[model samples]
Target: MIPLRQLPRLLRIAGVLARHRVDELLPASRRPRSLAWLRALMPAPGADLLVLPRGERLALALTALGPIFVKFGQILSTRRDLLPADVADALTQLQDRVAPFPAAQARAAIERAFGATIEARYASFDDAPLASASIAQVHAATLADGREVVVKVLRPDIHARIDADVALLRALAGVVERTHPSADKIRPQAIVDEIETTLVNELDLQREGANASLLRRNFAGSDDLYVPEVVWSHTSAGVLTLERVRGIPVDDLAALDAAGIDRVALAEKGVRLFYTQVFRDNFFHADAHAGNIWVDATRPADPRFIALDFGIMGSLPERDQYWLAENFLALFNQDYARIAELHVRAGWMPADARLDELEAAVRTVCEPYFTRPLSEISLAEVVVKLFEVARRHDLTLQPQLILLQKTLLNIEGVGRLLHPRIDIWATAKPVLERIWRRRSGPRAVLRTLRRRVPEWLAAAPDMPQLVHGWLSRANAGEMELRVASDDLKEIERRLRHGQRVAIWLSAGVSLAVATACVALLAPAGAPPGARWVAWLLGAAAVGAFALAARRS
Candidate 1:
């Protein structure tokens, strides 16, 4: 049930829908009073009822709503093939800039979160925001040592607002699942779950700080990429302080051109960085849009990427990682059958799926791209189509991998914008090959043995004692045997219960028979004829129990 206090918000949402002439967006056929009543208050003018492209209108409305909605739009934009072309294009323009908060409020919130004055921690602090995003805004500041840094502050009342929105989204998802036929395909609840995970992660600035620190460690001593340094002393869940980065924004092509930077090399490095993160380190930044990327034009010929946001990231399970590496290598080698086999082996498709059929499905999606020039190839489009085909072939792709695929598409987008002719496959293939060779070759086996030899040596002293203990247990008659069965588990339970009852009843019958036999053979003994009869009766009872035992 919607809370009483939250009904007003629900009414407001309905009002927004009514004003936008989108009452059909809400399923009011079921709840006329709650949903339709609001729509009835102010009917959409006839002029407003005209149909535009569903995707574009949807994207525009989401972006206009605010930061949270804009972020949602950006996420949906990555799923181009799932959406109509016009809507995806509109959502692609949903950048992360928003109006900044006042300096007083920002400083006060930071002081309250830290329980101290900002002056004590910083030599100088600016109230003006250096940049404002949907979730948080960053302000320029200086530490006590006169080192420049940026302070990221979460928007006030964001948690409460998000909590309310999530509640509504969950309720809406439940409603859609019940009413809509395509709910199972779209997985509305799962999308909301992903959003909840990503948004909650964004709320914790300290976690983002740690992510930055790890990425910095991964790329240490490298020239292709750089991550800002997190100032541990000043970072918190609500606020983060990082070494301020000075670079031309990756999206600012004109500025980079002015700096004499090689856009082609910059684009190639982006692909290389992505592969290194995925295949080499098995860690990657999931959110890498133009706004989150910057170019260090300090060295024009050797430009390095500066990654900002780290809240949303992705990594694969080890098995998936292996299959993905093999898949990429196979694609590079034009081995579609190998790709099909990997998908089946990885349980990405049904176990009974025919290899040839799957190979054909893959070829149908990939063949068009193969004939295209590198400059004309949209890697994102290829991935989206692959997903479409995979769904048809019964592939329930992992959610984590979906995020990675979207991130890769974003990186590819940035790359294509920088240099249209860069061969992403060429850059990525060598990295995957090196990783596969290191993991699956004879040298890897030798390395593994070398690492394990010390453990083997350590166990040598205890080997004889362990053998002796096993022998001693065997001789003492204290051994236990266990049998495992999966096929007859139910039958086994029933059989064991039956045996317990049969054993008790048999013992009772045997005792009675023995007593009768003793009485018959007493001093007041039975005559010869009767004694034979008693023996016969006793034997019959014993034989009956033996039959029961055999059946059991």
Candidate 2:
């Protein structure tokens, strides 16, 4: 259920869409059957969208919905393969080109962020925004020391708006999960939670600045990619300032061509850079859309990529990184068995899962892709297919893996757009091979052992003391041991049964020997008590032997 306070925001969202005649743009199948009555609730019942195309109406409605929806459009624009060309083309307006707020508002925001006049902070601050989005607008400026930088300021009251939207999303997630039959499999709430974390992180300019600084340091001296330097002194929770870079926007093919850039090489470089970030460095800029990327065509022969918008970066745990790299290598080798084994090894699939069945499933998903030439294969499509297969096999879906898949899709779109024939697998195989070789080498084994030597040395002094304590306790008949497992318990029961039977047999044999010795060595005139004792011993031996035989 929607909260009373958030209902207004939800109504505003619906109103904007209805005002733009958004329902007219949707295909019949895309609209939910339950929401068929939405048309009756629209405010502008007579609104006509004859002047705007369906795609344009969508873009307008998204813009009116607010910044978050605009960002969604921007991301959707990257997947041209999935969207209609008209809609995808229209969404480009949202990427670093969303309609800016008033110049006065921008100025007010800057002054509010720094608590001083613009001139006092920047050598020259522009009132007009360089780019604007739902959350913030950026202004290009010159620093006091003649360094060019871009100053980003958060949108006014963005926090409250985001909070309201997030609450609405949560409410919607709950409603869908509870009411929809397939919701358990989809896990809409989990997805919403992930989105909330991402959006919340993006709201903090200080965090974004830190992200920029760390990424800059990661590729500090590299020519393949460059991360702009952050101006730490001017950065704050609501404001971020970073060194401005000049380059041709990555999507501008004409500009790249005019500048003599080698598109194929640039495309290949993108693949290498992605692998390096994900596997080698284990850190990547999750949002690598064309809007956040540029090409330094000044060095056309040696093109370099310039990255911006460091609000969302991703990294995996060390184990996942290695497993993912191995998975990639296994793909290249067409090792379906290894891939199946890897799923179990990575704890993605249950240990008892039939490897042969998993292998066959993998082959079913992947074999068709190899029939096509490597240059013609789509990396994103294959990844999607594998995800479906994973779901079928009940594999444990790792959130980090999802993040990596998203990043890969973004990268693949950018790469294919730049060079249609560039083979992603061909470019990535050697890099993964190199990483695997280094990690699996004997030197790595030695290095790991060397690192543990100090730990072993520190514990060496206690070993003898531990040994002595165990021995002393054993001698005092106070030793104790405990282990828990059904298999071990059964073995323990059998061992105990065998030990009892052995004792019983030994006692019976000893008694029998004693009884015989007493009878054989006694004199003819021996007392009746001796004879009775012998008879008693013989009878006891017979009973003991019978008990031992029954047990055995």
Candidate 3:
């Protein structure tokens, strides 16, 4: 059941959709049948609004709905393969351009966060916002020590707003899961959980500051990329202060050209930087949209990327990191079979899935791209196509990978915008190969053993006792083994049958021995009937042995 407090907000959302005529965008088959009656309650859209393209109207409707929906639209914009081109293009405007809250409210938020007057915190503070996005807005400020910085303040009541909207989204996701035919494949609920986690992390400015600091440290002396330093003294949960830096937005081709920047070098550098972050450093900027990435114009010939907005950062499990690097290498080598094997081994695909079929599917998706010139090929598009094929073969989506996919799309887009003829695979392959060699080399293995051997030695003394305890538990019938594979289950069944046969055979042998002793060692005082009884028992033991042998 819907919460009473959420009904008004739900109605408001529906009314906004109706007011912009966004419902027309959804096909009749895909529309929620239960909410069909809500259309009657909606006010009719203006004729002028109706004349606009459905994609634009939908984007406008999402903007009207609030930051959460706008953010959703921004993510949707990246999946050009999944969405209509026109709609995707329209939704791209939502990235980092949400309407800002009032400056007075922003000031109040800052004051509340610091428990001090705005004048007391900084030497000089700008009331005007430098940039505004869904969760926060930034203002330029000067520190007491004469350093220029940017102060990021969270929006007022953002937590309550996001919580309420997230709850509503979860409810709707449940409805979709129940009603939609492809819900299992699409995984609406999992997507919501991923988005919720990202938003929750983004809400904490201190966490963002930490992420920035770590990234800065990782690339401390690198010429290819620069991360702004976080001002720890001025940062809090609700606000963050960072050393202010200026650069041309990566997407601004005209400005870059005016600054005499080498677009090709810049594009290649971006690709290499992405590989380094993911494969070597294992930490990456998850949100690498054009607005957040900028080009330093100081050295035109050797361009560098300046990263901002560290709210959404991503890393992978060590296993995933290795597998993904290998997967990329396999793709580069056109080793579809290896790719298929890697997917299964990495638990991305079901173990029982046909390797030949998966390999063929992957080839079908990737072969055409190879036929095209490297300049025209899109790494992001290839990954998306592979994902589509994997989905057909029951791919298990990893929630952690969602950010990586989005980041890849954003990075590729930025690269293409900078240099139309950039060869992403060529630029990334060498970087990946170097990292892979370092990680998988003999030195790496020795290093791992060196780190782990001491721990193993410390735990070695308990090995016998632990093994004894486990064996005792098994003998006591207190242990249960669960197997997921059909082959393993079949093997277990056969072993159980063999165990029962062995038990019966042992009983039979014991009975036969006892019967022989009774027959062979009978005293003269014993009745003659004892020998006959022993003979009968021997016959019964022989029968039991025959039954056990036949069953085996």
Candidate 4:
């Protein structure tokens, strides 16, 4: 439950949602009349807002809420398989079309970011926005060198707004964990922490610029994709400047046709680009919605992709990358058994998970698709189905893979929109095979060894001395050899326990023997009481020895 102080914000959220009639997701007859009084207090929306579809209204409400909600909607929009079709379609607009902060405020943010006048910073700067999104807005500008660039200014008060929304979400996550029956499996807190980290990283424009720079370096000479160059002199923690780029938006089919662009080739390239980035380079653009992607149609015969918004890039650990590549290859080969084995080896499935059972499950899900048209195949859908099957066996899902999943969904979405006939498997196999060769081949081993030679050489001179000392000690009576055996630990524990019991048993026996000797050697004048005491002591010693023996 939220504190009393946060009720107003929560109430405001409810009111805004109610005003937009978002509650109509449930039947109107289901709502209590007590809520009508609160609804009556809200101003009536115009026909324009009311006439729009339910999904649009919901998207608008989230946008109005702020960047945090916008981010949530953006992530939600990617999981079309799990969402209502209309809502998923409408949510794409939230990607980079959220209501932007004012232009004048944007100017002040830019000035404050650079600590200089606009005229002094750029030879020409437009007050009008070229593009606007929840986190930032871009303006056209020209440098002193007559180079065109776009200035990205972070919206003012974004940090505070994000902080507030995150706090509210954290509170909600806490409530969910406490009340929701499936909280442990869902891991709401862990989800929120990931969201928090991503959102916080996005707030720093310098970090985004760095991401863009690294991506640019990765594809410096590549013609398949182009990343805009960052203008370091104009970039800051709150503002980013990159070379102005123009391309046909990926979704604009009419423009693409008009430019004589090859849609089929473009789609194939998109698939290849995704695979190469993920398996080959181990980095990919996680946020790949249409709004941040475009196609360079400068040459109608050839089309290249243009990527923007480097805030969220995905990378996998070397182990995952290798396994994921093999998984893809396995899928391409229709090797269900290989896929099942890989899943088990990767710890995705439980240790005791039956490989044959998993293989049968995968075959049931994928065999029909193999004979179907390539155009109808969705890589994302296949992976999702596999995940569902694995869940039946209690799969341990990795959080790091979520970003890759989202990115894969985005890639498939773009590919489907551009060319429905594009064969993702055909496009990805060669790339995966090449990556596999480079990963485990002899050349890879040589490269690894070359990198490690210096460290090995530094320790090589001590190897002979260490071995000689071991031999010398072994040759002498002082040698103590320790063998590596799994049973040694258990044996050592039992030996120590038996040693303690033996000491007690020996003491008890000795006491009894001494008592017997004293009794036998006593003078004839000894008191009857002393003899009774000796007999009692002997009985006690026998009891102690028996106790020790029983314990041992």
Candidate 5:
């Protein structure tokens, strides 16, 4: 239940929705009867609004609500499969272009963050904003050393506003989870949590600066991408200062032509850079919308991408990274069986799901796309189809990967916009294959072993005691095993044999360590006592190994 403190805001939201006639979007059966009285009490929308499309009205209402709601709309826009085409299209137009707060307020925020006057910090600071967004506004400024930079200042009291709205959203999500029939599929609470995490990360400018710095370091000397340097001395949590950069917007094709830029090469580079960031570097700029991406025209023949807005960088967990890379390769190869197996092995699908059925379902959905020209196939659509198939097979989608999915869509959109004939599969396959080869090769195994051996050796001494305790407990009848079937009984038998092998191996390793210690620490002029101790340890090591070999 929503608290009394949130009731007013709840009513405000209901009123906004009603005014926009969003209730009409829902069937009468699904609409709550309780909201009827409230709708009657609220003021009606203007006639101008009544003439607008329902989707546009909804978008406008969300914009009227605040940045948090607008952000929610932005996230929803990416999931075209889940929403009506018109609604998703309308939401795609929802950009982060809100009116800027007063210059005095921005100045006050900067002063409070740094505890210094604006004049003391910069040589000249512009009062008018260069660009204004929902959470922050960017102002052009010059450093004391005459370097130009852009100063981004967070909106005043944004945290309190975000906190209050987030609490309201959580309450609403709980209500929907309890009441909505499709709550499991919608996962409203998880979506709210994702929005909250994204907002919280974006709220910290210092963290964003670090992200920009790291991305810059990763692409240092690279011809494909350029990241602006962060000005640490002038940056803080509430304010960020980055080196100023200017380039043609990536979506501006006419400008590219005017500048004699190679659009085809530029588009191919975007695809390659995206795969490099995700698979090779494992760190990618999640928000790669046109505004944040610009093309450097100075090198018209060899263009580079200038990235902006470091607030929403993304990285996958190691397991997800590997599985996703393999999944892409499987899709590229049209290996539906491998795709099905991967989904199950990655724990995305239920273990009991029949692989043959899953493979058939995937082939049905994806095989048609292959009939089309390679350039005509949309990678985003293929991913969406995979997700649809996953839903049918009881797929457990990871909340953490939503960012990567969104990034993929953005990259594809940009790539197609730059060069409609670009084959994303062809461009990305080589990058993934190269990464897979590097990661799974013999040298990689050797590197991993070198890094892990010390840790294993340090823990070797404890294994003998642990294994002995387990065996003693089993022999004492303190451990019980109940098998429900012949398969389980066979598994139990194998487990017992494995335990015995573990015990022998542990004893062997422990004795070996003791022998090594005795030999390494013994006196050079072998005193009889020290020599005997060394001999005993060596003998014990040999005996333990012999026992282990016999047990196996």
Candidate 6:
């Protein structure tokens, strides 16, 4: 049942739709008079024409609603294949714009969450937020020892609002599943589940703090990526304190140009950083939108990427990481057959399916881009085509792999935006090949064996006993292997019954055959009827044995 107070909000949402000429997107059964009444309350002259495009309007609407919608738009923006080009293009502009909460509120939240006063903990506290998004805002401050830091505070009562939206989405997803067959293909429920998990993780600033720490550790001693230090002493579930960062936004081409940064080199560096994260580290920043990325332009010749928003990071399973590395290398080398084989080996397709057919499909999707210059090829299109082929082959990707795919596409997009003629393969291929060789070559085998030597030594004492037990089992006719499961109970029962039938038939056939042989040898009581009976029994016994074998 719908809550009474929620009706007003729902009606207001309806009214906004009618006012903005987006009523068509809503269900048709809603009351037109109520919609008209809500539209009447809309301010005059409507929104600016520049913002009316579906994508831009979506961004504006999400921002107006708050963080939940903004986050949704961010995820949606990654799904270029599932969305219209215009809508997807516009959603790229959605930033986490939010009004910072007053300092008093920030203090109150910190106090409530940590049971301490701001002044007692820090040298000075600022009311002004360093950054604000839909769910949380960050404020700059100083520790008593004089270290600079930033505090992240969750938006007041944001969870209640987020929960409501998630519940609504869950309910709507059910309806879509029941009514639209396409919903099953797209897996709306799974998508919602991913969104829910990511949002929940982001809500806990402590998790974000830990994520930042892991990333910081991963990039330690590296010059390509910078992850800020988290102040563990002050971090909490709803609040986080970390080292403050200052850099030029990568998208600010004007600022980059003024700094005399080489746009081409910077773009290549971005691609390299991405490959390093995904292949070498297996951990990557999932959210690399322009706003979350910055260039440390202090050294124009050696520009480094400054990543923020660690709340939504990604990682792949070891198997997926290996497969992806292999896939990238295979595609770069134009090994279409290897790509097809990897898909099948990864259980992305049925074993009985025609490999030639899949190879043909891959060639069809990838052939057009072969040997083309970087400016002429669309990596994003290639990814979409791969996804389409996967769907046709009934390939269900691991969730982590999906994130990796999206992150790769996002990195490519950002790279191309910086330099239109950037060759992604040129920048990433060498890194992938090196990693692949290290992980798959003879050296890797030696390393793996070296790591396992201790365990092997520990097991050496048991080898003699293990071999003896194996030989003992081979000598004993009583030796048997059995597995138990409830699902096979009926089959087991049928097999037992069939075993008895086979035994009785075999005995009867043996008696008849012996009698026939004796009669034929003695020729004293031999008869045509007896011979016929013997032959019939022998045929019946053979048939029973065959049936029993099949049943077993």
Who wins the lDDT comparison? 5
Residue-level lDDT tens digits of model 6 in 1-552: 446656666665555555554543334664355656665787643557334765566566666666677888777666654566667667767877777777788899999887888888889888877788888998889999999888989988889988888877666567567766477676778778877888899899999999999999998977778888999999999999999888899889999999988889888888888888888788889888788899887878877888888898888888878877787788888888998898888776777767888888989989889867856676666866777786687776777776666677778888988898998878878877887777789877756755664464465456446645654654563443344886577677776677667766775665555454445432345565645644554564455445434434
lDDT, candidate 2, at 156: 83
Worst 10 residues of 2 by lDDT: 74-83
Q: What would the per-residue lDDT of candidate 1 be over residues 1-552, giving only the tens digit for each residue?
A: 566777776766666655554444334554335445665677554554346554555655565566787887777665543555566667777778889988888898889888999987788998879989888899999998889999999998889878878888778778778777777887788878877887898899999999999999999989999999999999999999999989998989999999999999899899889888988888999888898899998999888999988887778998999888888788788788998899899998899998998889989989989898766767667767777777788887877777777788789989988987778877777777887787779887756655664464466456446645754664564553334776577677676678758866875675565454446323354465644544554555566555445444
Could you tell me how far off, in angstroms, the CA of residue 196 lies in candidate 2 after the best superposition?
Answer: 1.1
TM-score of each: 0.78, 0.77, 0.80, 0.78, 0.86, 0.78
Q: RMSD of model 1, in Å?
A: 17.2
How accurate locally, in lDDT, is each candidate? Answer: 0.77, 0.78, 0.82, 0.79, 0.85, 0.75
Task: Please provide, for model 5 over 1-552, each residue's C-alpha lDDT reduced to its tens digit, 9 standing for 90 to 100.
Answer: 899999988988988888788877777888876577767887876899999987899999899898778977886776554666578768877878888889999999999989999999999999999999878999999999999999999998889988988899999999989998889888889778878888899999999999999999999999999999999999999999999999999988999999999999999999998889988889999888888999998999999999999998888899999999899999999999999999999999899999999999999999899999998999977987788778778888675465677678788989999999999988988888998899889778767755664565466566557656755665566785778999999999898788767767776775665565455544356557755654564465556545544543
Model 6 root-mean-square deviation: 15.7
| TM-score computed on alpha carbons, candidate 4 | 0.78
Q: Which of candidates 4 and 5 reaches a greater TM-score?
A: 5
**Residue-level lDDT tens digits of model 4 in 2-90:** 77777888888878887887766545765535446667889988899999998999899887776668887776665443446578668
Q: Quick one: best TM-score, which candidate?
A: 5
Q: Given candidate 1, what's the lDDT at residue 540?
A: 51
Which pairs clash inside model 6? none
Positional deviation of residue 57's Cα in model 2 after best superposition, in angstroms: 9.2
Pairs in steric clash, model 2: 67-134
User: Against the true structure, candidate 1 has what lDDT?
Assistant: 0.77
Model 6 spans > 4 angstroms off: 1-6, 14-53, 79-86, 458-552
